[model samples]
Target: MLVDIHNHILPGLDDGPESLEEALLLAETAVANGITHVIATPHHRNRKYDNPALAVKLAAKSLNEELLKQSIPLHILCGQETYFYNEMLQDLDGNLMTLGESGKYLLLELPTNYFPAFIFDILLELQFSGYIPIIVHPERCEFLKRDRQLCYELVRRGALFQINASTLVGENGLTMQRFAKHLIKHNLVHFIASDAHHYKNRPFLIKSAYKYIQKKFSSQYVTYFMENAKHVLEGSVLQPIPPISFKKNSTKH
Candidate 1:
């Protein structure tokens, strides 16, 4: 069962599908791409979107019902792609939605251009509070690209990383593809998810991404990512392999 840990397939949630009809098309696209399960990670606390946990859960429940009614063969789990904020920890008791509603894993999105100084402290606090933070799309962050050591430290501090399938399959660009592969070689990335927004434009590419991983890396690497996604959905404890520092001369495109 291919489980996507990140996606925005719920209607009227964020920049995802505009209506239920569009969201169903996106779900069908996922099923065709070999995804059996997906976490409907609507954007929350991302300044522009404000999807509370209850609302997200209700939306996911409705979508799942519709899928069953229409025989879509896809399941939608409740989750949120929450932006890092100052009071994130405090908000956990209230409206924050964890991945799969597991409470053990949180899919966190950081600022694209800069890495905040307080992020490390927040990650540590989250760990101490019993939630493992999965940093979403670190490969796309400018600061992480400039300082790979920071990403290494984030994993060292118990934060797992998820890269987009688009990054792995070169849909985003060659530069991002290389960086995604670099992260994989150094054991920095733990999960590969679609992050799919539209049924046509930003559709799921997990099948091709895993195929690329199998070809470039190995089948074992593909299995590792696939298994990790299952463990995350089950809320199982995951002790990721320590990330090695990115040596300047060691990487090749």
Candidate 2:
């Protein structure tokens, strides 16, 4: 099954759909795109939005019920896209929700403009605490984009990287798209999620992105990403290959 690990499909939780109608519409779009399952990752502990685990679970349950009523062949699972904070370990130990409620993977977002000096330390702590920190949208982060070695180190340190589908397609911009492709070519990307907020603006583009991956890379690469998503949902250990290095001489400019 095609599973989206990062998405904001729940209503009134964060910067996603505003009402039940919008949520249902996004569900329909996802189903049509051949996505069978999605994790409703509402923002948590961000300065603007803070959706706790229990509340996100309740919202996901309600959305699932509505999808059933509407006959939408899509399932919504509970999760949260938590911003990195000093108290993250404490929060996860307390009541923070991990991706798909599996407790094996946590969707983490870093600050956009700067990479915190303690990021590696936090990631190590998270790994020691038995949670795999999946860094969301590394291609879009200015710091990682500038320093590819940092991304490589994070992956080597047991942290997984998730690339937004839009970033792969240049929907965000060419620079992000280039970095997304760079990560994929080096086997640094473990998951490809929609990070979708709306149907029109930031819709689920997994199908198209996979198609692009198959054509540009190989069918095996597509399977690798899909299988990683499945493993994440099942809370099983992911099979990550050693990442290849991107030679600077191959760049055009």
Which one is best on TM-score? Answer: 1
Clashes of each: 0, 0
TM-score of each prediction: 0.96, 0.96
Model 1 has how many clashing residue pairs? 0
Model 1 per-residue lDDT tens digits across residues 136-177:
999889888887877788888889999999999898898999
User: What would you estimate as the lDDT of candidate 2?
Assistant: 0.88
Q: Name the regions of candidate 2 deviating beyond 4 angstroms.
A: 246-253
Q: Against the unseen true structure, what C-alpha lDDT does each candidate score?
A: 0.90, 0.88
Error of 2 at 127 (Å): 0.8
Candidate 2 local Cα displacement, residue 67, angstroms: 0.6
Query: What residue runs in model 1 are displaced by over 4 Å at the alpha carbon?
Result: 247-253
Q: For model 2, how does the per-residue alpha-carbon lDDT over 57-105 read when each residue is reduced to its tens digit?
A: 8999999999999899999998999999887888876569788878899
Error of 2 at 115 (Å): 1.2
